[model samples]
Target: MTTQFSALFPGLDNPLILKRYPDSSDANLQAWDAADEHLLKHLDESGMLPRRWLVINDSFGALTCALRARHGDTPIDFAADGRTAHLGALENLQSNSLCQQEIHFHDCSQLQSLGNDAAILMKLPKNLNFFADTLSQLSQTLRAGQQVLIGAKAKHINQSLLTLIGKNLGEANASLAWKKTRVIVVTADGKPRPLSKPNRWPVPELGLILENHSNVFAANKLDIGARLMLDNLPVGDFSQVIDLGCGNGVLGLQTARLYPNANVHFVDESAMAVASAMANWALNKLNPDLGKFHWDDCLSHLDAGISADLVLCNPPFHQGEAITDHIAWQMFNDAKRSLKPGGLLHIVGNRHLGYHVKLKRLFGNCKTIASNGKFVILQSVA
Candidate 1:
């Protein structure tokens, strides 16, 4: 079944066509949320568009698409931490018969390239640390007394959040609630603030140290699922191994420790996560040639020539604020497609996720290797 999201863009007569990246089969998930609509609405009502637009953290590029649709000639710059956001934005732009080349695309790491002259439009991220880092980065390049407009659910807007924004960027205030959403208007002070520092934590049992940026999952600590996965690793003389959705490279680092000669690949959608994994690999003094890092959505972009003998996964059940298993579903499917004959897929998940059922359906055999009260280690063979 095919599902398409027509954006709730009030200005456009026909809604802009949009879809989530990797295109979810589940209809419940959407490319854009209310916050995105609220931001676009504010822009429309302002009566005059910004001279130039700088958009941040657009989930699937709804804001970019709407802006492009309304004023095709305006300069629009977009940035986000996830590769999927960029890809989805590009796809949405093309689907709506808009020229993608009109928009300047930047990854989160490319914040320096984004000039401060444009009107800054932002979607309040779930990770305030990442948001603060963004503000700090903007403070460096943006002119003194510049303003940034942020859109978020009304419930998420509060004084503490405003203070955090002001502390990093400038004084902030929220607009009256509209559609259960509020626009946080922030004025950037001329002062530059230091960016968010990476977090470091030690794994005494494995003799590994991990440093991750603000957006990386379990950035500052070892998560319980990974801890459980580490204990139930499968025994195999594997050569090509992949740490699918490797966050901070914990599973891959430990796998390399167990199998010194096997090549380990760390793949993730977040640029920071990939960087963190690569850094952790070097921090552990692993063989430089044996470890590979990729900023990717699942194994969708993995090189076809590289077939994996084993895949270690601690799949994320959510994408952004949506608590859907689409990501885990895609991860499982990609792992099957990337594995060699009879290759093993080892994963850890909460007992309630019913991943065993998914594995059984995909591979025809799902083996429960280990279980605790909260987590289960499941294995499947291709």
Candidate 2:
């Protein structure tokens, strides 16, 4: 990633300084994208600034930082499903020396708390269902005739996309392409749409019923790798456990079921994911005292005194649109730090990911406890 980001958004007299979350080296990525620039460029040209503004799905806070830089006292509100995005945006704001005194940070779930007239600027997200859910929720609060501007790659805009927006929020239209990106203008209808029901499915085999919010990974079904890991979990005496990246808390839920005495910690970066995990734990009637749910970036912010005798992981391979192994690499390193001496890290991954190589390097020893044609379950001792 670029060590420093300098994007010349049109409204700003000077370029804004920004950086991706968990800042480090890797030149393959930048802090902002053309879509982000397109939205800001359109705003500068429109000259229709509202008393307050809400920025959504800002990736690394490029839009929030740019808007904050250009209009410091505008009472900007920022929201994203990713905790990492929130962290990145706050850092970018401080790094640029922008005053956050009037900038309000919130989750989309709290849209009702903000002013109804606040203009919304958003970058289209990768997940359509989550976007639809957000639109439905926003429609409940935003007043009629309000505009929500969404930016996306030109290739991603289409009639069907507009239709989806209309059904959920209001009428929509697209603008001329700039730098292979376009801004979508949506007019709010002020009609309340029914919120989407949480996805609930029975895992009769495991005697578990899983409920997942729209943004949770594998929310609708049991992923194949998790299925394999569930079958081959290392049987041992375990007391304290961590489910790193615990989407929907399935792994941690299973831990609570198998080892009733163990403290099962479910940690994830998505707020919906953490909430879903906690909800699922309650839904399954698991022991309340043994379950802990955390919305955090891996285990980095876990309670200081907490250490795990066992860590179960099904690490994600992608961050937003970029497919990379950096996340899995971080999870392994974090597991090593949080594990007690002689503790174990058990993970399942696609056969092609070569995770065993990294595990061996980090833990000094890695064992292939189970394998199938598509997935491999590996274990490491700290």
- For each candidate, what is the lDDT? 0.89, 0.87
Instruction: Estimate the Cα RMSD of every predicted model relative to the unseen true structure.
Output: 1.2, 1.3
Which lDDT tens digits does candidate 1 get at residues 243-275?
A: 999989999999999999999999999999999
Clashes of each: 0, 2
Q: Write the per-residue lDDT of candidate 2 for residues 1-382, one digit (tens) a residue.
A: 3578688888778888778886746666778999998898888899876888988888888988888788768988898888889889889989988888878877656655554778899889888888888888888887889899999999999898999999998999999999999999999998878877679998998999999887889967889999998898777789999999989888888878889999999999888898889999999998889899887877878887888899999999988987778889999999999999989999999999999999999989999999999999999999
lDDT score, candidate 2: 0.87
What TM-score does prediction 1 earn?
0.97
For model 1, the run of ten residues with the poorest summed lDDT: 107-116
